[model samples]
Target: MKNNPHHPYHPIIYVRGFAATQSEIEAAVADPYMGFNIGSTKTRLAWTGQVKRFHFESPLVRLMGEHGYRDVFVDGNDLVAGDFADQPIPYQSIIVYRYYDEASNDFGSGETPPIEHFARGLNKLILRLQDKVCANKRNNVSPEDFRVHLVAHSMGGLVCRAFLQNKGLGTEKARAAVDKLFTYATPHNGIDMRIVRNVPGWLSFGDANNFNRERMANYLDLPKGDDVSIVKHFPPERVFNLIGTNSRDYSVLRGASSWAAGDASDGLVRIENATTHGPGADGRDVTSPRAFVHRSHSGHYGIVNSEEGYQNLTRFLFGKLRIDGILDIDNITFPAELDKYHEENRAVRASYQIESAVSVRKYPWQITRREIRENSAIFRTYDQLFPGQPGTKRPPDRSMSPHLFSVFLDPEKSCKASKSVSLLCDLKLLTPDYEVDGVLFLKRHYEGGVIYQRQILVEAIPDTNAAGGWRIKYGDQENNPGKATLVAESRPLGDGDPASGLVFSIPIQQKSRPGLHGALRVEVRPWS
Candidate 1:
C-alpha cells in the first residue's frame, strides 16, 4: 500500500552473514551474489538414505523465474557502469552488498572494516540503488516504488539493523528505502556459547567485538544495559527471521562451535537469540514474524541454501495471500491420577511440536518438519497453563496463544493459484514433567522428554473483500479420515464468532490419548 499495489516486490539487497576467518571473509566477498548463487546437491538424505534431490537452483535464479527480478551483476562488475552504458539497470532487481570487498583479493587492500563501517556502506548502497533504479527514465519506477527488501544472513542482519538503528549510521531516506528485511539464522539478540553466550568482557580483539552485546549495543546505538532485541527505528513487523534448528549439521570449527553453542541453536546462535526483540525499547511488545527450519547456519543443510529457507524467502517477498495458524487452547487435559502433585508448586509442563508441510504439486513443501528434533520442527508451549487457574479472574482474550507459524501462500507458486491455501501438518505434544525428588528428569531420544504427535489440515478460502479476506477451515486429518475438514465453517471477519478474526479455533479431538484435548485456532494475516 505504501508504493504500488503489488506484493511489494521491490529490489532486494543480499547481505551475507559473518565471515569468521580471513579465508572465509575472502570466500564470502569473492562471490558476486555473496552466497545467493550457491546451490546444494545433497539436501538432507531421507530415512532410507535415498536422497530426495531437491535442487533449489538458488534463491537468485528462483527470484528471476518466480518473480521478475534480475541480479545487478554483469560480466565481472558488481554493478552497471558509465551512464548505463547503452543498457539501463532494471527496476525490480537484486544486488549483493559486496561489503567484504575491501578484504577480498579482487577488490581492496585485504583489510576488513568494522561492522559500523559495513553498516554505513549499506546506507550508501541503498542511496546508489535509489539513483539507479528509482530515478525517472524509460523503464523507470518512481521513488515511491524504490523500497528494497534486505535479505541477510548471520552478522549481515546486524549490519542492516545498525543502518536502521545506530544514529547517523544511515540517512532517514536510506532507512525508508528498506521496505522489508528477511534474515536467515541471524543472531538478532547476540550470539552465545554453552552458557557463556554473551561475549566476554576481555575478548575485545579482532572482529570478536562484533557479536559482543555491549559492542553491538554501542554500534547499534542501543540504550545502555538493553538487549539488542529491542528495536526503535524500524517497524518490527517489517522484519522476518528464518531460524535454523539443526546443530549437529553446523560443523563450523570442526564441531567445536556447534558443541559450545549447544541445544536449540542453529549450532551458533541459540533459538532464543536468533529472533528480534519480542518487545521493542518502548515496551510495545512488537515481535517480528519468524519461522523455524530444520537447517544449520550454513552448508548443505544450512538455512540459506536449503529449500525451506528459499521457500520462506520467495513467499515473503512475493506471496499475495497470507495465513497464520494457531491453537485455541480451551483445556489441557493432563494425565489423570497426577493431579495430587498439582497441590504443590509442581505441575506438568507441556511443549507442543508443530511441524507443517505446504502441500503443493510442483514443490514438495515450502517447508517440512515431520518429527520433533532438538532444534527442529518443534514449537514448545513452555508457558504453564494449569487446570487450577480456570475461574480465577482470567485475563482478557486469554484463550489464544501466539500463532504457531505464518504460512505465506503465493499464487504463482501454488498449483491452483489461490483457490484455497492448505497446510498438511502434524503437532507433537511432549510433556516433560518437573523433577520429582531433586533428580532432573528430561532426557531426549533415550526417552524422557518427547511424547505425542497429531496430524491435521488447515485451510482458508481467500477473499479480497473481507478484512484479511480469509475464510478458514481446519480438522483432524488422521481422526476424521473421509471429511476434507472437521470444521467446515468459514472464519469471516466482523462476525461475532470468536473464530471470525485471524485467530480461529482448531478443536483437538484426540480424546483417547487423554492428552491435552483442547482446540487450537488459526491466525491468518498479510505479512508483506
Candidate 2:
C-alpha cells in the first residue's frame, strides 16, 4: 500500500443531530406541571426521517467513501449513539443536526434546549473525535493538518457561531480546526417564528426557573450583551457560508402574514439570514461565512437531499477546483445602475461645485499608424527598439493625461509605479516564422515608460513572469551603419500622441542554447 505525501492521516468525521436525550425526556415527563408526555421536538423527528431516507443513501455514502472516509452517523438525541472513538483516519466526515423542536402555541411549557447549551455539547463531541483519531498509529495527521467543515440547515449556522465565539470553546487553534462552515438557512439574528405568543419563556430551554427575556438574550449573544459576537470575533478566512431562498411559506402564525417581510424565504428561514449579516466589508471571509442562492428550501426536511442542496454541500466541503482563478462566474461587475451614476459624474469634483467655464471638457479619441524602419536582411534578431534615432517625432493624435491608471494589487504582492509619471509604451515587432516565411509579419508589443526604471538598460521588462520578454543591452544592438537604423514613433490622437510608432533592428546572434532571455532596468530620475 502507498500513501501520497499530501494525504491527511485523520479522516473527516461527520456528527449528526440536536438529538433527544433520555434524561431530558424523563425530567419533562416527571414534571408536576405536565400531565401527558409532550414528546421530543417536531423538528428532530422531521430531521430523523429525512436523514434515514436520503442523507444516508448510496450516492452520498459512496461519494464520501470513495475519498477514504467513513460516514459516522450519530443520533443527536442519543448523545452517546455513534462510535466516538472508532473512526477512519485522513478522510472527510460529517456531523448532521437539526433544531430542538417545533414549539407549538404553548408558552412556559416543555421546550427545546438553549442553542448555546447545544453548542457546548458539540464542542465535547469534537474533542472526543480528535481523541479517537489520535490513538491510531497510522494516523499521522496533526490538529493543524486536519479541518472540520460543517454543513448545517436551518439552526445549524447559529450553533456553529455559538461554538466558535463561546468562551467554552477555549483557544484559537481549537477554533481553527474547523476550516469551513456552510449554513443552509441559519438565522444569524433571531428569526420571526412568532415564539413570543406560543411558548412562554421560549428562549429559556437551558435553565427553566430563572428563564426570562433578558437572561435568554445574554445566552443568545444579542447585540445588547457581553456575550461574544461571532461575526466580530471570527476572521472571514476560515468560514464558508451558504443560504437558501424561496417563495414557499410554512409559517403557522398569521397564515404566512408578514413572515420576515414575506417576499423571500426558504418557507422558514429568511434569505436575509441565509448569508452573513449586513452590507459587509468589500471582501470574502473563508472562516466567518459565505452564501449562495437556491431555488427551493427543500421543505426544510429535504434540504440535505435535494440536488441543489447536495451540490452546494459537496462544493462547500471540497475546495473549489482552480482553473486560472475563476469559480462559478467568469467575471463579475458592479451593477449597471452604479456604473451609470459614475459615468454621469465622471468630471472631477472640487471641494465645492466648480464653475463650468473654469473646468475643461474632455473627449476620447483613437489613433493607429505603421512604419518600416529597417531592412529584413540586416534586422534578423528579435531584440530591437522602435523610435531609436534623433529628430524622430510622432504627432499627438490622442491624449488623456488627466486620466488615472493604477497598478494591480493582490495579497501575494503589492506594487506601484516607482515614479509619478509611469509611462507605458507599446511597441510592435515583426518577425517571420521559420516553417513558412515568404514574409510573415510576426507583430509583438513591448512596454516601456518613464516612471522609475530600476536598472538602466536598453530593453523593456515584462509585466508578469510569463513567456516573451527581452531586455537589450547597450552593446547588444549592432552600431555599425549600412545595416539598419533603430526608429521609434508615437500617435496620440485624443488621449495619446498621434503618429507614434517605433522601428529598430538588430543582427541575429547564434547561440548554442535553444532560447535566450535576460533582464534590465532603467535608472530612476526625479521629475523636475
Candidate 3:
C-alpha cells in the first residue's frame, strides 16, 4: 500500500530471532533497536586466492544512508517528549518490536511471551505506528494506505508470519497493511536437527514447541493436515526468504548447534526448510522467492550481518526489476563407453549439480552465488530422466524443474540511469554421478568427467512497465558482447504458471563431450 515517491518507503519493523536463555533474552531487550544496530567487518576471498576486507555498516545504517531513514533516538529523549509536536517523521522509519523487553530484568516479571502474543503485539505495533505517522501532516499517508515491511532474522521470521497468517492470533487488517516481508535464515518449516530431523512432537519446553512442525502448523493456521503450504493470508511472492548454506561458520552455541544442523544449512536452519511455503498455483507445495547464500545462521558470518543478505534486502525492498532463473535441459550425453550400456537397456543413474551465480548490472556484490565448493549446489536429479522401460517415468525437466535463483535490480542506482540492466551469470553443471556398465559411480567415486560451465548474459528491461520481460544475448567473451545472437527469449513470472519462472537458454559445450546437444534452459520470475 505504501507505493509511489510521495510515500515511497515503508517503515521497517525488525523482529529478531529466538533467544532461549535468560541472559540472551536480557541482552536482546536492553538494546532499543535490538541487534538491528549491529555492524560487522569481514573478509571477501577473491578468485585469485587473495582476501579483502569489507565492512557492512549494518542494515539500519544502510537504510538511513541510502533511503533517508532516521532512528527514533534523538537528543537524550524520545520524540513524544515535545508534547506530540514534531514534523511527522518520514514514512521511512526503523522500529524494533521490543517483544523481548517483557523478558528483560528491567521490564515485566522477566518472562517471554508466546509467539501468538508476539503476533498480537505486531498487530498493535502496526496500528500504533500508523496512528503516530498519520498524526504528522507532511507524511500525508491515509489511514488505510499506511504499510510496513518486516525484516526479521532466525525465529523472528516465525513471529512475523504468525502476525500475518495466523487468523486467531493476528488481525486481517494488520496483515493487509504489510507491503512485503523479508527473512534471513528463517526455518519456515520447523528446524530439523541432523539426528532428530524435524523437531520432536514432545519437545515443548518453553518456546521449543515453536519449532515443532505440527505445533507450527497449528499455530500458523496452515491448512489442517497439510504441513507444507504457503498460508493464504498473503501473496506467496511478497515474502522473500534468504537461506544460509554455510553451516560450519556459525559460531553460536560453541559450534554444537551448527554441527547438529549438519550440511545444506546456515548452521541453524537447513536450506530446504528456510522459506515460506504453500501450494502454488501449479499445485506444487512450492516455497516463495528464496535464494541461497554462503553464510551461517547468526554471528559474523551470519545471514543478517553479511553483504549478501544486505544486498538482497535493499534490492528486494527498493529494486525496480526482478528476475527468476530456471535451468532448462534439452539433452544429456554420456561418455562413449558409458553410452554403450545405455543402448543395452540397462539401468544408469545420474544427477546434476546445477550451479549458478548471478550479479546485478553494476553492484560489486553478487546477489545469488552457489557453487559446489561452497556446499551450495542446486541438485536437479533423475533416477532416469531418460529411461528404457515402459513403466519408468521421466518427467519433463522444464515444466517442473526448480528455479536456480532470482536477481532483483534497482536499475537507476545499480545501472546508473540505464533503461536496460545487464547481469553476468556463471552457470556450471557438475557430473555429480554417472552409471557405467550397470555400475553407479558417484561424483566422489569417479576421477574425471565432463564438467560444463558457461557464461550467460541477461539484459532485463529496467522498467516494470516495459513491454517485454527480457532479451537474451549469448556469446563467448572472445567475441563481441553486442553481436551475440539471442538464443531464447524471457518472460515475466506472472505471465506463465505460478510455479513456472523466467526462461532462458545456454548452449552446453565441452572438449570431452563436444557433441552434447543441450542448452541450460533457465527461467526467472519477478519476485515481490
Candidate 4:
C-alpha cells in the first residue's frame, strides 16, 4: 500500500544497544528481535503511588497491532536471507539490525568488530531492504521514494550516527534513505562517571573505549573541539532523543553504575548528554526534539521497554503536528535584601532553575518532565542569562533562554469525541537563594520556593478556514481547572510558512519582589 502523505509509515530498522560480555553477545544473537520485543507489565502512577497494571506489549507487537506493521521474519525463517522465494514485504515492516550476530561465536567470528564495520553493515542492510521492498511493483515505491526510520537504543544510536555522519563509512544513498532517527538513553556527549570523568580511551576491557569521547570523535568523524552530539551531515531536526531520568531503578552492576553516573543520569547516560543538536534554519545549532521520561537506562524498567518510550517513538514516526515550548524571560526580580546587597558591588551569586512537565489532555503520564526533584531541571547561572551585566535588571538574552520541551501530536490519536489536540505545560521557575561574598544569605529564605508557577493548557482545534490553520485557545489551569476560555490567535513567525510555524505567546508574571516576568512562547507547526 502507498504511504499517506500526512501520516507516512515507513519501514523501521531496530538497532539494539551495546553488549559488553561474550555471554551478552551470545544472548543478543539468540533473540530473534534482539530485545526489541521485550515488554513491561506494570508502571508506577505518578500522581498516586500505586503500581498500575499498564501492559506495554513491546514496541514490536504494538507497532504490528496498532499500525498494521509486520516483521521480516516469517515461520521461523529470515526473509532478508531470501527464505520465501523473494516474496515482497509490506512497506510498514520491522527489521532488526543484528550487527552483534557477527560478533557472536554461534554466528560468526568471536572477535567484536569496530563501530565502522557496523555502519557499513547498516548501509548494506538498507540497500538489501530497498531491493526487497521495491521488488513489489504493486506497492508503487521507487528507489528514490524508499525510506526507512532508524530506531535505536544506547550505543546503537552511535552506530546510526556513524553511518549518517561519517561519509567514509557509508554511501550517500544509504544516508539519504533514513527518514528519521530516534534514540533511547544514548550518551551522545560520551559517558561520564563520578571518579573516572570521561571514559578513558585506553579502557579496552569489553571494548569499553567505545563510550569514550575520543573514540566517538574518530568513529563519528567529529572535529577535535566539536561535540559528538552535533549532527553535521543529517537533518538534525528529524532526530528525536528520548532521555530517561530514573536512575534508582537501574539494576546494572547491582546499582553501582547508577551511583557512579550520579543522580542526573538515566542510570547509564547522563541527562545532559542524551540529546543531539544540529544547525537550524537560521544557521544556529539548535537542540533536536527530546523528551524525558522517568525510566531507567536498560533493564526490566529500561527506556526501550517503557510505554513512554513507545508513545514518543510512534508519534515522532507518524505524528502530524509539532509544538515547541520556550521561555522568554524579560526580567528576574530579587529579594529586597538581596537587591541591596547586589547594589553594593559585593560578589553575589544566584542561579535559577526552570522545571517543566508536559502532557496531552486525558493522558495519565507526562510526555516530557524536568523537575528539581528529579535532578533534570534546566539550570542557568546569573551571568549566563545576563552576560556582562550581572546585577542589572536587563532582560535575559533570548538565545540563552531555556527550551523546555518539544512534543509531537497526532490528531488521529486524539479523543474521538473532542477531535481536538490539547497540550498542557506545567511550568515552574524556582526562586534562587542569594549568596553575598561567598556567604549564604538565608535571612528570609524558604526551602522549595518558586518565583513563578502555572499550568498553561492550550487547545488546538483544527479549522481549514483559520489563518494559521488552527483555532487556538488557552487557559491557566491553576486558576480555572479544565477550562480554556481565553482565545489565542496564531501569529506567524518569520515568513509565516507552514514549516516556519505559528507563534502563540502567553504572558507570565508574578509582580512580587522576588518574581519572574516572561512569556511562554509556543511554536506550532505541521510535522510529518
What total of clashing residue pairs does each candidate reach?
Answer: 11, 78, 12, 0
Give the range of the ten consecutive residues with the poorest summed lDDT in model 4.
1-10
lDDT of 1 by residue, 1-528 (tens): 254533377878888888767788777766667788887877446679886755767888878887789877676555632345445677778888888888776678777788889999999989888887655375446665668889999898999999988867999888887888888888888888776758775665548768888877888788656477766688886788898888899888799989998878888988888878544545667667778877888887788887788888877777766666555555555445333443454643544554444443345554644245555554544353333452243332453353566667765444375577677665666554434335444443334343446666776666676445665666666777423455444454334453335656666665643355556566666555
Query: Among these predicted structures, which one has the highest lDDT?
Result: 4
Computed on alpha carbons, the lDDT of every model, listed in order, comes to 0.69, 0.34, 0.72, 0.86
Model 2, span 1-528: residue lDDT tens: 023233322233232222234444444334321211111111212434552222324224545554454444444322222454544433444333322322212322345556666677666656655555545556655555645555555445556766776566444655656655556555454443443421234444433311232443455444553222236345543344444444343443344523533445555544444445321244432223343343334333234444334443543354221001000111112124322432454321101000000000010110111112211011221112111222233222112111111111111111132211112211222222221123322233122211111111122222233121111122221243111122212112222321221112222222322221121112211100
Ranking by TM-score: 4, 3, 1, 2
2 versus 4: better lDDT goes to: 4
Q: Estimate each model's TM-score.
A: 0.85, 0.44, 0.88, 0.95
Q: Which should have the higher lDDT, number 1 or number 3?
A: 3
Position 11, candidate 3: lDDT? 82
Report the Cα RMSD per candidate.
Answer: 4.3, 22.7, 3.8, 2.2
Residues 275-329, candidate 3: write the lDDT tens digits.
7766566666655777778888888777888778988998788776666666655
* Deviation in Å, model 1, residue 197 alpha carbon: 2.9
lDDT score, candidate 3, position 92: 80
lDDT of 4 by residue, 65-143 (tens): 9999999887788887564655678788899999998899999999999999999999999998888887877667887
